[model samples]
Target: MMDGASQFATTMLLRPWWLLALLALALLSYLALRRVRGLGAWEQAFDPALLAAMERFGHVVPGAARRIFWPVAVAAIAILALSGPARRIADPDTFRNLDGIVLAIDLSRSIAEGGSLDDAQAAAQMILQLSAGRPVAMIVYAGEAYVASAFTLDALALSPVLAVLDGEIVPNAGSRSDRALDLAATLFSEAGILSGDVVLVTDGDHLTPQAFDAAAQLAAANIRVNGFLVEPTARHGDMPAPDRDGLERLTRLGDGSLGNAADPAPLADTIGKRAASALAKGETAALFFRDYGRYLLVLALFPALALFRRAT
Candidate 1:
């Protein structure tokens, strides 16, 4: 429950500076009425006999309410209308475009052994940073897939969750892009949201034929799968051979492009642009406020109309 003054405050001008001008209008109207009535404009305009002839013999004489009262009332109502009275109101018809992005990380031993897991993690963080203010989810996959973080707009909140992804989390020893893609699709289905992109961060050492099928399905649903191939930055190393063809094929099937983790800035820019474009295609409803000035104008009409009526 609000105190009387607090309740009154919200019912009036949101920007109270306008009220000063409204008060001035009211004061000017009062002063003008006093000056005009003191000069007796009606009396000056007509003779006493003419005024007596205009009044009906059997009818009641016009009182202050029928004369000064209605004009004052009209002026007061007009002043109130101009004062810009407003309150916080909900308008549920507002809309905006928003999209979600899912990051699928391969946690197989190959990524751990090749020492490119950090590369994948770094790529994911970079994507997260580039795609700020967008809903992001994380999935870690080895032989099976696990949701490291649910879909959310707060990318920072999911950073810790992404930091813990490793081969140990999955307990299995194999990598299956099929499993990861399938689970990511299921997450999208459950969330009932349109995603701008699905980012696959992996060495692609264990990509199966089924991964292509999954990518096709995702593409059919308008969810593009972008791939990040985490490669060794050095010229010669014992790093496991990344399945370049597999990443290329998966991205092709998913209507997406493959990116190198070594240089993620371009990839981030590409994904960011595409995601923003995709997100712009859809809109979501939200609550807002509508001004009541027109309603006040309608309300002011009642007192204004009364000014033209004769007293009975």
Candidate 2:
């Protein structure tokens, strides 16, 4: 909720250039006023002294000079209305519930070796099911990144694709979570999403500085990067352990949380809460000010009516 002063602070003119018409109107009004004072063509035909005598004697009615003011008033109001004054207002229908989510799944060889691919897939599925109709996107990354799905309201559209996502599907070898984050940011940019979430479902393998940097960038853009650590049920002695510390740091830098894949409901709920908070903060891509310029036209009606009545 904004105070009156705060709302006034945000007030702006959408068509500020139209305010220049006020200057033109001022010039035209000055010329019209001069013409009214001079009694039109009579001033050109007769001497100034004779015209003064006619006005003094009440022979040439100069009452029309007052009428000139009516038109000037109307034009001034119309110009103001055209300038398009607006102020920020909470519009629930348009701005609320506009936040989106992008799920970035890791398809690295380590996940297959650790045998946590099913857990990763299940975590992704639970998030999609709990997304509450928000437009969701997906990115699958190994050494490289690829968009599995663009933004869509239908969560079912992504289920089939998520079902087939495996470590071998991506031709690349190593895990590059940074590429996943970068690709998620690109998806948000293409879809004009200003604020959203990026949920990373991975075994937290091959974490690097670049991955943290990518998460920082997403945080800067008002997009949180959460992690769903898919711990392996059958751990291999040769395989690297899940980097919980690194994932925690990544989420911290990205201003999000780290949730275990064993229970994905909490992460899904967190995403929902963050989205609701964003809506409360008016941080959606559709956030816009309500233009009050049209209402100003209603004020012009008063002067317009005055001019009309005078003409009759």
Query: How far off is residue 176 in model 2, in Å?
Result: 0.6
Off by over 4 Å in 2: 1-98, 276-312
Candidate with the greatest TM-score versus the true structure: 2
Model 1 agreement with the true structure over 1-312: per-residue lDDT tens digits:
467676555453533465576577678767766755443566578777767776657332443422566666666666566655665342211111235678998887777666677888888988888774667888888888888888877777877876877668888777888998998898888887655578999877777889989999999987889999987444236446788888998899999888998777888788766543333223421112234655877887887887677757
What tens digits encode model 2's per-residue C-alpha lDDT throughout 1-312? Answer: 468778788677767899899999889988888877666777689888988888799888754678787688888878888887877565433432356889988888778667788889889998888777678898998899899889988876899998888768889888899889988988888888767899999888888889999999999988899999988877867777889999999999999999998888888787765543345434332256667878888887887787557344
What TM-score do all the candidates reach, one by one?
Answer: 0.57, 0.62
What would the C-alpha RMSD of candidate 2 be, to one decimal place? 8.8
Worst 10 residues of 2 by lDDT: 277-286
lDDT of 2 at 196: 82
